[model samples]
Target: MRTNILLASLVVLGFACQPTKQKEETASTPEKIAVPVLTKAWETDTVLLTSESVIYDEFRDVLYVSNINAVPPTAKDDDGFISIISTDGEILELNWVNEISAPKGMGIIDSSLFVTNIDEVVEIDIPSGVIVGRYPINGAKFLNDISISSGNEVFISDTGTNTIHVLNNGDVRSWLNDSSLVGPNGLLHQGSHLMVASYGGNEFSRIDINTKMRETITDSIPGGDGIVSYGDHYFVSNWNGEVHFVDTAGNRTLVLDTKTKGQNAADICYIPEKKLLLVPTFFGKSIVAYEVK
Candidate 1:
């Protein structure tokens, strides 16, 4: 009987020595992202016709929109044009410059407006509404967005060929033609560097103009078509109808989403003075404005 009591005592001691099991807390909790205040200011009529890029021209105090009216976006059928619109959503000129085909981007240098065509960069006299010069990038398949620096240097992205061509003193040459560019779509000249938004991948990078070095900033916005930075915050638009407001610290918040509505957000432009973001809906054939605070 003593032996049986000792064995039972040992069993009790074994149970007491075992560690208590407590539920573990998760390592990373899903953060509650604040939906930014995206108030719809105004949406233009259906006259834009496949608007791809919308840029605010501070010189003219208006916005220029590139429209591809053809079914095949890359077609050069003399139907593509640029439209002028007021900040209050009025169509100033339905067809501002009617000579270009498949115009995709617009950049200003003095009195000229530089635009990207299928495989060429067309320079137009803004005051005269005439095509002044055409710099063709030979063997370029799809020339996309255009970025002009304060020093009047121009850069254009070729998404089809995965390259970027630069125009220095009216001479157009391929600056960087590597696959590492990763389908560069939107080109933004931010001071000393050029910010690239990759359409083929979900990333944004800053590239050194001289060294061709790249520093990826974020890889959250897939199909990122347009990017603009203001006050340590970046406004990025995915072609899939979503816009993200990302701070310099790499925090992403879904500021706008129109995917459920079956609309698109292509190349967008922002006006810092008015705190407005203009988004071009590709298939929707309209340019929309949202007040960003």
Candidate 2:
């Protein structure tokens, strides 16, 4: 009987140790996955304009940029304008949309241009440049970038509130308000995730569209201002004039460096049809274009 009891106790101890051993084995297992890298396809030094922000319209094959400066001889009060440029680095229209108050983030949705200015999200007629409507944001002091998801939901980052607000047909509500995101400036939507360029925090965050769960993809992207998705890679630009290419696996590489000065790079737009990258400078007051292969 004593031998049997000892054997039973040993069996129970072995069972208990089995789960701990399995947990240790699982913890020691390596996550085997391939990471993507950027190959230097081509580079160009062709400059465009002094645009503070840029966005690409794939359907129109054009790039839209915002110049955050005083409009010449106008009562615009340093209000900015949007410029439309061709793929070959030609300024199609210098003042695509006029009288915009320091337009920072721009998005093109269904022939309408959505821009964040001051603390409101305004919609403009793309061709006529007429202000169609505006959505007032409460508790938002400084609004930055705007992004549209596949479901036509508009997301705007409120720098002052340290939150991201979602707008659907003029109904505005908070999507994310976390201490981790400080001065969210640039916004982009890829797949079901929203990519944010946190300027004050010097980091980038990926948030789920449905659950709003966020994960910090990278940090210390100084002057993190603009973000765009191209092919299978995501490109982020800093006001320091550095462009980083991040692959699907979240590995980043310094792809292009610009010569602009003092918070120069603000926004980036990828024109896939033309294989071009459009970068806007804030203080340098110029737009730089690069050929991406």
> lDDT, candidate 1, residue 203?
84
Give the Cα lDDT of each candidate: 0.85, 0.75
TM-score, every prediction: 0.86, 0.78
Runs in model 2 lying further than 4 Å from the true structure? 1-50, 70-78, 259-263
RMSD of each: 7.8, 7.3
How do the residues 45-125 of candidate 1 rate in per-residue lDDT, one tens digit apiece? 977888999988798898889988886867889899999999989999989898777988778888888989898888888
TM-score of model 1 (CA atoms): 0.86
Per-residue alpha-carbon lDDT of model 2 for 135-157, expressed as tens digits? 88888887888888888888898
Q: In model 2, what lDDT does residue 162 have?
A: 88
